[model samples]
Target: MIWLRKTRLILLMLRGMLICATVFPWASVAMRERLIRNWSRKLLKLCGVEVEVQGLAPGQPAPRGAMMVANHISWLDIYVIHSWHPARFVAKSEIRSWPLVGWLCEKTGTIFIERGRKRDAHRVLHHITEVMRDGDLVCVFPEGTTTDGTEVLPFHANLMQAPVAGGLPVQPVGLRYLDAATGEPTAAPAYIGDLSLLDSLDMILRSPPIKARLVVGQMLHPMSDNRRQLAGFAREVVADLARADLVAAAASVSRAHQVEAKGADQPATV
Candidate 1:
């Protein structure tokens, strides 16, 4: 069993790290986006995981200078978001010391955050403010803690403070895992603890193919609403994710419903 775990870890450490250190650096920021975009796709394939975008409108690219507020789930959520929006992850301070992952993220310019440390939070806030002023998008998981993908947790408003510095529009994202065949969303998707990347990868290496559904809800305008209100908005978005395809396709249904009802008097003859 240890041999199997080592096998997956070694592969991830090599491929994921080498790709970032060499290929990821030479590329300019613009070129970096292309590199990461392609790189993330390749990484997903290696992991044997498939990603699908839900609830994003056609032609809607992630905001150029925006704050993306995502709910916490599996550690792999980082990859999914970056693959969509080229940005730095707002990760816990602990992740800053995580072996190869830490090194890889640091080299790629990830902004580390220390929750509950007032001073550290302030520093991260200002740092990200500068990032935004420089026109970079920032991804923040307000949930503060990981969940089993079964429910949305509370949003820690402290991180939202950075966006308020400039009325930064917040993009709320809802992520979930599904039974590929049944299309049922389930919490078994959440990954927590020392679920080492290698161990997680090994799990995927054997199981039946699983698809991760990432739903990008509408961008929320920064409001006077405290973190609780913001958390509320984020939760609503996640709740709506249960019927993602239907939600995305229902505008016409509502429109037709209204139009058909309007002719009730005329249609009575039928």
Candidate 2:
């Protein structure tokens, strides 16, 4: 079953590549975004993940020209967000070499940054500022690394400069993966700590259905010209959202377990 799923995902990716190569060049920007959103939803369904977006009205369009900052948990994070907004992303330069995925990302306007080189970071930041200034939405995982679904790591403030420089709004997006049945944070989808992308995919396919909960926090304006302060504020909002969701999910699961226990303790009605 897992292999079948993998086969289907690969085929879909190939189809995406073909479209990107043949159609995207001529397709309007709206057409391309619609295709990306549909494709991303399909990928999530294939992986048995359901996305529930909160804090956005049904059918509401994603914010334009805002810099979206999200806490990274897995490679699937991109697809999860794209399923909802189809925003162009800023990813590591290494992903530009990731076979099919890499080419697809580049074709879709993803900005790749070489980590660790101050000059390259500045170059990418400038490019991101220009893109945002043109009224295109761009998302960056400011955590600088992926984490398990349990926590949001400290954000790297460098990318925050794009919004600060462009005088754009920064939106904090919180993502959490949960067990569909138990509502607890799930590890199956986490792509942390030495796990290859293939391994992560296999884990997700083998696990039970997963729920990707995306919380869109209120947009923050750059109060001052300080990128670090803006990054810290965004991180705080994301962290609060994540922690609140975890507590709520846990409470719901506990209530469910209590109900089951109470029913079991009673005599059978036959």
Candidate 3:
């Protein structure tokens, strides 16, 4: 069954890639956003994943020209977020060579940064500022690498300078994956350490359905000239949000088990 599902998903992804490669670049902004959203949602469904969003109210508009910083996890992070809100992402330059995936990312306006190069970081920051100035949302995983969904790594402060330079609000987003049945946090989606993309995808494909919970925390208004301070505050916000969600999920699960226990202890009627 896993292989069958995987086969179907691969076929769907291939179809999506073709559309993205040949047609996405020609579409207008509105049309492109709609297509990307629909495509991402469908891909999540095919992967047997569902998303539950919190914190941001329904019908409330996301801040214009805001800089969004999220914790990095799997490659699915991009599709998961785009499934909810469309934003141009700043990804590592290594992604630019990943065959069809790389091609689609470039066409969709992703800014690739060459890691370990101070000059490249400065160049990308300038580009990010321009994109934010244009009233388009831009996202970055300031953690610089993936982690298990349980914790958020420290954010790299250099990129936070983009929001400061553009005079844009910085929004911290928290992402966590939970087991669909037990509601406990799951590490199956973490793309960390030495795991290759194919290895991570295989793990996700073989697991049962999971829930991607996104917590949109309050926007931080940069009050100081210090970029490091801004980055620290944003990281604190994301960490707090993630911790709160884990506590709530654990409480809910405990209550569920208690109710089940109480029911089991009740005597059966004659």
Candidate 4:
């Protein structure tokens, strides 16, 4: 059954490649977005991940031309976000080496930056600002690297310059992965610590259903032209959302344990 699921996903990915090869180049901007959003949702379904969005309504209009900053945990973060809101993403140049996925991302307008190069940020920032000024939603994972979904990392403010240059508001997004049935935090979807893509996929494909919780924070207005300050403030907001979810999950687990203990204390009725 797992193999079947993987097969379907692989087929779907090939289909995505075909579309990217042909239709993407000639498609209208609106058409391209629809395809990307729909395809991303299908891809998640094949991977057994469902999205649970908070702080935004179904079909809600995202802030146009705004810079979206979010924590990164796994490669699926891109599609998970795209399933709801189709935005051009800024990713590391290394992703360009991934098999079909890299090509797909490139075809769909992902801006890749070479890590460790200070000058590369300026180059990428120019592209990001241009897209934002063109009224496109551009997303950046300022954390720069993937974590295990339990904590948020410090954000690099280099890319934050896009918002400051354009005077655009920044939207902070929080992501958490959990077991669908138990509603507890899960690590099956986390692609951290030198794990190969195949290994990560094996874990997710063999685990229980996963729920990706997305929390969209308020749009932050630029008070000063300081990118570092803005990045710090945005990180705090996103971290608060992650902490709140963790607290709620802990409370849920505690309640379940109490219920179990009370049941065990009672004598058998029949």
Among these predicted structures, which one has the highest TM-score? 2
**Model 3 residue 218 CA deviation in Å:** 1.1
Rank all candidate structures by their TM-score, best first, as comma-separated numbers: 2, 4, 3, 1
Candidate 2: residue 263 lDDT (0-100):
46
lDDT of 1 by residue, 1-270 (tens): 546545655686678678777777576898877767666765665555588987767897677677877777777788777777668878877887888778877866789877678888889889988888788988887777787776676677777777766666666677777666677764444677767665666665565556777777666555442445554555555545534644642443344334434533343342
C-alpha-based local distance difference test score of model 2:
0.84
Residue-wise C-alpha lDDT for candidate 4, range 11-50, written one tens digit per residue: 9999999999999889999999999999999999988999
List the candidate 3 regions with Cα displacement exceeding 4 Å: 244-270
Return the TM-score for each candidate structure. Answer: 0.80, 0.89, 0.87, 0.88
Model 2 clashing residue pairs (backbone): none
**182: Cα error in model 4, Å:** 1.1
lDDT of each: 0.68, 0.84, 0.81, 0.84
After aligning candidate 2 to the native by TM-score, how far in Å is the CA of 49 from where it should be? 0.6
Candidate 1 residue spans exceeding 4 A from truth = 1-12, 186-189, 193-196, 225-227, 242-270
Put down candidate 3 lDDT per residue, 1-270, tens digits, no spaces.
778877887787788788787887688888888888888898888777899877777798766698998888888999998998889999889899997788778877899999899999999999999989988889999998899977888888989899877767887788889899988998888999999888988888888889998888777766445678678767777776665564543343344335435544667565
Candidate 3 Cα deviation (angstroms), residue 266: 66
